[model samples]
Target chain A: MLHAPASPQADLQSEPNDFSAILAEQTDRLLAQHVTPACLKAADGGVFPAAAWEAVSDAWLPLALVPEAAGGVGLDAPAAAQILRRSGYHALPAPLAETMLGLALWSAAGGAAVEGPVSLATGLLRLASGTILAEGTMAHVPWAGAAGHVLAIAEAPDGARHLALLPRAAYTIVPRRNLANEPRETLHIGTAPLGPDALLPLPAPLAGPDGLMLFGAFARAQQMAGAMERCLDLAVAYANERKQFGKPIGRFQAVQQMLAVAAGESAAAGAAAQVAAAAWNTDQFPLAVAIAKARCGEAAGKVAEICHQVHGAMGFTQEHVLHFITRRLWAWRDECGNDAHWQERIGRMVCAQGGAALWPRLVALRAAANGDRGTQP
Target chain B: MPDMRFATVAFPKDAEDLRLQVRRFLEAEKADGRFVPHRSSWNTFDPDFSRRAAKAGYVGLTLPEAYGGHARSSLARFVATEEMLAAGAPCGAHWIADRQSAPQILRHGTQVARDHIIPRICAGECYFGIGMSEPDSGSDLAAVRSKAVRGAGGWVLNGQKIWTTNAHRVHYLLALVRTGDAGADRHGGLTQFIIDMAAPGISVRPIHDLSGNHEFNEVFFTDHFVADDFVVGEVGDGWSMVTQELAFERSGPDRFMSDYRLLTELVDRIGPAPDARQAVETGRLVAHMGALMAMSGSVAALLDRDIVPNVEAALVKDVGTAFERDIPEVARRLVAVEASLDAQDDRFAEALADVALRAPSFTLRGGTREILRGVIARGLGLR
Candidate 1:
């Protein structure tokens, strides 16, 4: 049945457009040059890599999803997703993904584009009247300390939701870090409120309670996919280089088997991420994002484990560059709706739809994702 | 890394339309009591049902119209096949032939072979069984000692083939036979022949599975004569020919949906309002299934583009077969039903029992999980 010679065809279905591919290649090159081991180690010690952040900022990638009319690149979500995947591939030391998402959300909410990185706050947040006094603290907010502004949705006492852009001055950051030592600060809103322009109308996508969480999970899934690929790459390299007994460890069937499983996980994660990316802004977004997060999050742990095992004791130490990616995989898997979390959400959704509707719903999601190709909502 | 990527596939309007047509046909069949959705699956042999499906233009989808096929796109075929499997249609009789054998013949068989066999296959009157595994060669296919010597106008085959699914009943067996010496690679000098089951000098003995099913057989070929017109591809190229089709064999929805009925039954048993555990496990399975479907469809798309996604197919089968094996295990946990084939009144229990008995074959067939991982590892440059 498969008699055709192995060759790539010109009518490729999933190849990104020329513009998106060029942008992704450029982002990959930039990350390869700037996100050095020294930068990752320094950032892991709670010191932000200023140079890397500046390079990212100078490229105006944070505004990638913002409208071109809004003085931004106006790339689609999948294009931005490619950049996010690159960030995870390099174990990027800055909050480029968060900022890019925040800028998109802010611009969609009719807010003007802002300079510097922007962190996203998603939790129980409330804004009071008058001076715009806020209640509730957002914990584990990515780069809250380093970001120039925090984009959040807060409910007023009357129950009206407001999309607020809180500058660094309006919030106090109780600095914290994730497993990878990336800034995951807790933000305490100051009693002094933001300016009148801080509040913008909530966009349709963000109107639902799960909107922000879904986007976060979607972004993290893409990042996890990239991180898992890095883990597989690292593990494959180690297996091919590290000698065991009489030959390279890769020559051993046992070692080869484990890395093969890791390779499978990485490929699955990448496919899941692509599905989620394709489903962005579509009706399939919520379920697709949930599946992506759960699948990618699940793969991240396995990939990290195999990579570490392949490296033996060398990968356990702070000296090795392998942990830079694996540690981030560990952290990102739990950041936005971990495996269990999204699994339960997916469970509820699937259960609500019952068993008979499952296949039709899944097929519909595929059709929607396929039909919505390359077109922004 | 052998390009271990599954690019997303966009089903054309024709494919999408075919999905509804297939679904409607299955629903009508179900409504007419043609088959029990809970009891029959793709493995359940029903020649009448296969004939009806063939009449509906689904049996030989993607094959050339000259041979009585629909000549539809691969995506269209994919949609039809998935719909059939999803509805638990008893497509066993034509499944192998429609999926691999007929396509294989179309691509590599002699003109006489194609003219003689493909139309019968497309008509669903002819069935084919795989003749790869032997007594000593299961996973190590290169160890196949089945040989066919040059005799008269063709080859005279004298060898035994074990674990041949439907060999006792199928019209033909695409057997790999040794025609010459084994080269350094052990993959050379072999050839494929279309063994006519009804021809002389061949006998089949049934091998009952754990579930007491006679789906497998051990066939003995005592000087079975195969005409030259039945030769598939070039002599001594059988190894590559067989290996090339692994992607197709391993990457379809059949790998994952073998026990899909159990999942649907589990959901129905638990009702719409499942407890937290049931919901979570079922949900996880659904997520895995969704991902597998995406990956499988992407592979179908790649094949449609004439790109062989061998590694990607391996990954899909590895993950998918695991998912298939998990269905019965998770079902038993979610609902407190003793799995038993005797539970005729309990659809969930019966389905679970049937699937649990067959679960071992899920990963074992097409390619074992270990072998698939090895293939993937080779793609990763690990070997």
Candidate 2:
């Protein structure tokens, strides 16, 4: 079934002033300054980039997505997406996106604001009477070791969904890392006892199946877009600086062509991620995010290949800074349901609608997005 | 970073409001058996269909009311054009005139040319063919050998233009010819002229495509006389005019939605329940299309702002055409049917065959992928 446009009241419920230019500028400047190569390398070695994390914390970046009524800056999903892209651009070791989304989820669930970092986990839980029992293992829990709390969404046997805010100490953490050397640990929960207040009802959007995954995929798409932007930057700079046959390699059509393709891929990823962000909280969310995750993930691989190919052997070495962004791109491409996963999901949904319905469906999706505010130029 | 950004563009409410009307018109056309959607592409030339579409107020959109146009937003035109392409409407007769030439003429052509040509285009009684490419000038447009010399009342043109689509049928050809010395830049000598195809000293030879279609043509001009009133913009300023026109040409729904019909057929043919591979591949194509539409739509928004998105346009064509080419490749892989035009009983197979044969031109026309990428590389400051 096509995701119909949300009602006027439901649309008004969202923070209309979601994207603020001032916040976007401030976030961009902050990421550019503090999330430097040195901090990234330090975080790669498993040492928390305390200064960078503190800077973002001081800026209230983690709480940016929390609703203003909940005593936090009500940055909507579009603005949050821009910040996430910046986080990916700098390859910031901290789980800023994860934390921001986690806090937002927690706040929406009527949970009190907690300090420090928060990581996100998804699994199943057993709810009997008033007791909440979490016993499953959540793999690829981003920054679980560094976070002070874990925001989890687990489905119950009775088809009820609950959001649990559990302290990090409650669950056993097995440290792990992604291709970018950033923490993406696994959490093993053995009958973790959640306080009665720890379990709260979810917001409407997240009350459905794969709600967190939808947002997670959208976040990863934004990050991939940011990483692709950086990779293109590095490749273009290197192409103009690196000389081959007594001329800058950029002068060659082959190198220019490759970098050109990289630019297109980066633009496509940006467009997809931005549209997905704009579709947040609307009926178009699942379809838009699916397109974003699939398109951005596919663009990520092609862009990384071209960016690296343009940089030659230097980009492959650890000494070069391109890998900081490229590796994160690779890791993010696999996260939040990889390209094939989302592609199949989109394909199944679209095919079921039949070929005749595809045009109207796509137009309706665009129409719903157009009816929103964030999509304005 | 690269300064190459596809800004978020949403269809304006006015444009969205027009979507239902366009769909209704298309459906009515389909119900009346105006054209077979499965057998038609955007390149399908039918003057009767074009006339009806014009009467429905889709042609000459975004042009001035003074010139018999509706004076709608580019986004409105974007929505209308995409609707036409999606329905596989035979839009070739008015496609060029409504898309690029009419606008170019309105913007730069003489008062006489605009007054005479624009209204006819709006009425779907006039058509245009691009006369930029020549036998020796494919990608090297600046290397055009066509030249026009001062004549009795205008300039006498003499040269050859190849790959001119609809040359034999189009009433006019917007020919780019050299009129002066080729300065150091090589772009200095060019000029654009609105040539009357009915004039003497011009001949068109059909170049049959691989599918036995005669859409492509090679035209020879021997002293084809173009009056002074037909000149578009100032002499020696054709390069900028043509480049500006390209952003309009390369960035529209036409770039990516050429093979959209085949995609729809593929989805329907695969049925409601596709195997994992088929679903995954089809989904990938849809995702790519979604992104391309956004990118292309963003370019439309940029054009509406009068900010020439040259590089952005190039990126759209490059990526969009790639997606267009990928449709047939993906379609054949998921289904076990021999693609043939003779498979009249199987719409999917026939659509697949038609697109497979025409796919190569999607990238080659407007601008080749390599050329577009080169343009993008330049935008990235790599040139």
Candidate 3:
């Protein structure tokens, strides 16, 4: 009954261009057991509960050390992402995501970091000589401060790409600061030694320009979801409490319908995210991820702003939770490959895919938006 | 499951592998000719197919295993539904029962209704219909004029329900009768009764649609008696309960896949040697379908989480119907043919014709486009 999982011959990879179900199943398990009933407030380290991270680890999520023959889950990039999307829905925090990304980088370089805690720098904007001066600033990561070891993906001195791992003890940490007031920190790594324990083997670029675009798109989309939920909660509570012109605002059709549209935007955003996730998980198509992320980020921002309008003056208050939520939305929208970035990427793809055939592909992508992937009529 | 509300999760991708198992089961029926594709997946009648599907454990899909359901996830059902509609499996006998009646009964009907009706529904023999929509009552459902007066046996109902799909065939009708008048806030005082179609004083007349085939009916109930035990939920909770049922009806794959026949034709017509235009057009539609699948899957995930997700559900249904309608329009633009009445042997051509006729009413049914847009707008805070 107990046999080793069959090994995939690299040449045969295209023989079955599918990994969605596996990804979906693994993600299903992670969501079912690993994540907590509550989220990590940005102040509570801007990370998921320790229990949640452990739960994800229990599901072997961090083991997405793809190159490791004996490492954790033994999944590829696509499989790893499916779980990330699941973690996202449950708001699993960034620690787990960082770890998977780190392990992947390390595995590429023939190193084994999966056995211990590791972190990965995302949305890396390369400065001259890999001494990265980036907006992400090390801490404001979705779950950065808690991860054991941090890896910054940057361009090396040789003008080639290298994933540099910054040890937890290597740099001086700055106080957490963010719009959402979620847990985030900045590190001053003034020419610190790029230690051997932190390095991975790969010489070529681990993740491409398209990866950054899609990654941001996906994260922005998820953050939109978190914000949309926030919107619904704010509107519902306001409708129940705030009486305007002598009646509960909810009783009014105008108000009711406004709240409803916010809900729809949430659905639409979520729809984009799911399609991106499934496509990325199964086919690793950068274009689908780019489009999904673009739609989700732009739409989410719109949804968040409208929801605030629906909430009126009360939503603007610092005392209310909305200030915190909407602030996160504002920042997150720009964090993962912003709208402009993805649009450019999609534009490039469309141009390259050819104008004659591009329009249909866009339509196909739109049809593909809901995760349909031609499963049925 | 990761919450669909917070995540974009596609259904077919998540559930298709399992859905394939369910598909094989239903496909077996098709191969045996025991079931043909249902014209209207929800309202079409075929008792034999219903029994076979029931035997296959498709009905009462969400019920507890002890109650005979498979205890499947809502996404699984979503996959099964789209697949059935795609194949046109005639599941009318248990469609209503499985879709709304049994679920409502399970949640609010007497233990008698749950124990007796649910198992039979899962078994695929008993059927149910919605006793909503009167002659004048169009979309504003609260204005229903059907009255139910308490009688010695239980309750006596007198009302006429229009668009009572499969009324003549189903074993029961979930009649929304006014137990008393609670004016202005008209949602109150209405009670749901499991009216036996075979009972005395019930007359059902078939209504032909644009296709010249009989599907829906006008059902008249004159002093039709129902037991007090048949009352669903608390009296006056009918409005909230019925509103809740819309979440079930509108969110599934049925919304957009109605004209899938056209999609297949477009694909088949393209063949392997497609020109650049055909490939692009076909790919675009296919991709849109993928996105839609993800959205619907998220809703199914929502159901798994026990969140009502009413607004999100409404979005999928609205978008889905729009997409379903668009398939034919897109196909028409892509293909060349004389648009005519009556379906030819070509499934795509027939489907395109059918969709052209039925697409107008797609949004009108369950809830109108205007009403659904209002719901979406309200959900988005734009209204």
Candidate 4:
């Protein structure tokens, strides 16, 4: 029997202090110190930052989502997500979020904690006769070549779902990269032998395939929000420092207005991300997550455009570091699901409930999440 | 960049509980068929409904008990206001007086003003209109030529206020006038006075909007008399007071929820199982709405703490009004419905037409988009 280590749930429950703020501060400090322009340039040129990865791992970020008893830090979903937000802020060209999510998902499925970095496949796999097989090519698998194992949610012939852990060698890796230069490879999984220890029944809470997509969307929303903050910071600094009409460009109403719009977008994205993060523990997979992803993704495009416009020609060049954050925003918005993809889901749900039920449904969803009774208005 | 403060606010249990009571009240009104769910939203004038709502203790929620108000937290007021807007309740009659005028009187008006006006406002018998804009000074409020000279015992006001919503119907106008010269700062010498609409030398001419609605009016004052007790706050401090009052006006759910009924009607038209395009567009709008709601909620929380968040409030109105403007556009694209105000049977078309006509004013009223962005830029320390 593959007995899992003691869960970190008890330890996390005992600490009443806000770990999210502490973890956010720690991650911000780590990235500010380590993720330099030189590191980013190297990563952009297809060179992986093994040293940066080592530093992040040394900080115990990879174990951030797991229980402390499982040799993890026992940070809850929102706290772990804060770390990812900081990672995005620095545009750290590594698989930090992927590794954190992969480890947590694997451990949640009752798998023994592993040591090396892990990546998750985009789609579900098929399980038959105690063997796991890929239905089609799993596209845009994050950091596939670097990760030692790939985690995927698979469905069996009996319609039971399982979390399957496959060694990297089990599938052929077609190397690809997103706009941010992060590793977004494709996995061509043939018939792969998975021992009983590598397969665990999918947890009841996440039995449906939408769970993976929802989790991915939630993570990307946080990253986009953080990246937007960085963009606004860079644009504001540039606006104040650069002078076009004898005074700082910030003195110009046009430039100030552009920056103002960007700031509004950033604020909106940040608020939406926080709303989504607060709903991480809910069972219904709350529509707030969908709203967050859709809203943040839409804001990302506008924020990036405004920041670039405010920066002028210099922002379009490779010499500037603004691209480091903006590029990641561009990539993250379209990664889990684009704005259109999630928006459609929300629209369909609301439409299906009918016009009269719309406000009631929204109020009910909010009430349910907050443990309050639904209002009838 | 320095961190922008938009902390998440947790509504107290009592606030959430208030939501159920409000909803129940609204539900009873709906069951009784008090008024149709019209497209006008807060602009719908139904004095009977306002009186009923006030009798039910829904008006003057944030004022003190000494003024016949419930003195509930702003969060409680926020929940109630959102419920009213969502239900399309005809709250227009007391909306302005309840939202800003009463609060302003409580904060700045004299004991006499508060005693005479706040209780009536709380009882839904009194109504007020903002007297800020004039023919020459639209967004440039500081450039006002409306002069007020000292009389024997009070002030004689001479000015014209335009685009004053419900001015012809309301009892009073909190008019901002130039009491002194424009000093070096250009913000000094302004004064606010509570003027009686029915007094001598005051006349209101209705200005019908594009939708043929008589919601706005032009008020001309030749020698409008305002007693010393009607002066709001200190003399020569009207500029700051007016700005603070705008912070209240621009930050509420009204900014974003103006065209919400159109969204509900759009959903109804699309029905369940919307196609790819319909779902995607509708979803995008909902996403924007959710973000706006969160932003508006945070502003309410800040106002509750007595922190006048001018910049944050400006940002909310700018972003929120833009969101309001986008709903009709998105709805028109998702479904093919000819917009007409008189489309009796087609609720969607009627809503689309009503919103389409009213949407232009969303960014124009309270503050223009250009003015709001400038305010935001100043808040960002850019200017």
Model 4, residue A306: distance off in Å is 1.8
iRMSD of all candidate structures: 1.5, 1.7, 8.8, 1.9
**Candidate 1: stretches off by over 4 Å:** A1-23, A373-377
For model 4, what is the alpha-carbon lDDT of residue A327? 89
Residue pairs in collision within model 1: none
- For each candidate in turn, the TM-score is 0.96, 0.95, 0.62, 0.93
- Give one digit per residue, the lDDT tens place, for model 4 in A1-377: 11112432343334423344555677888888788999999999888888888889888888777766667776656556667778888888888877887888787767897876888776877765667564457888888888998887777788777878888667898889999888899888778677767888776546644657777787788888889988988888888899876999989988988988988888888877766655555643458778888989999999999999989999999999999888889899999888888888888888888877777666543443243111100
Tens digit of per-residue lDDT, candidate 2, span A210-308: 667776887789889988988988888899999989999999999998888888888888988888877876778788889999999999999999989
Worst 10 residues of 2 chain B by lDDT: B1-10
Candidate 1 vs candidate 3: which has greater lDDT?
A: 1
Question: How many backbone clashes can be found in candidate 1?
Answer: 0
Q: Model 3 segments beyond 4 Å from truth?
A: A1-263, A274-291, A294-377, B1-18, B32-43, B64-76, B272-284, B340-345, B373-383
Candidate 3 per-residue lDDT over residues A1-377, each given as its tens digit? 11113543242133222344545555656665644334444333444466766666666767653544545455543345555555544444445555665565566566654443564445353434444333324444444456666666655556565556666655556766555554456665555555555544433344666433344445456546545565666666777678889987776777766666566556665666555544543333566766566655655676677768878887887555565556756766676566566655554444344423442353334334344221100
What lDDT is reached at residue B251 by model 3?
79
Compared with the true structure, model 4 gives a TM-score of 0.93
lDDT of 3 by residue, B83-133 (tens): 676666776678778887887888888887788787878888788888878
Judged by whole-model lDDT over C-alpha atoms, candidate 2 comes out at: 0.85
After aligning candidate 3 to the native by TM-score, how far in Å is the CA of B48 from where it should be?
Answer: 2.5
lDDT of 3: 0.63
Query: Residue A357 in model 1: shift from native, Å?
Result: 0.5
Q: Over the true interface residues, superposed, what is the Cα RMSD of model 2?
A: 1.7
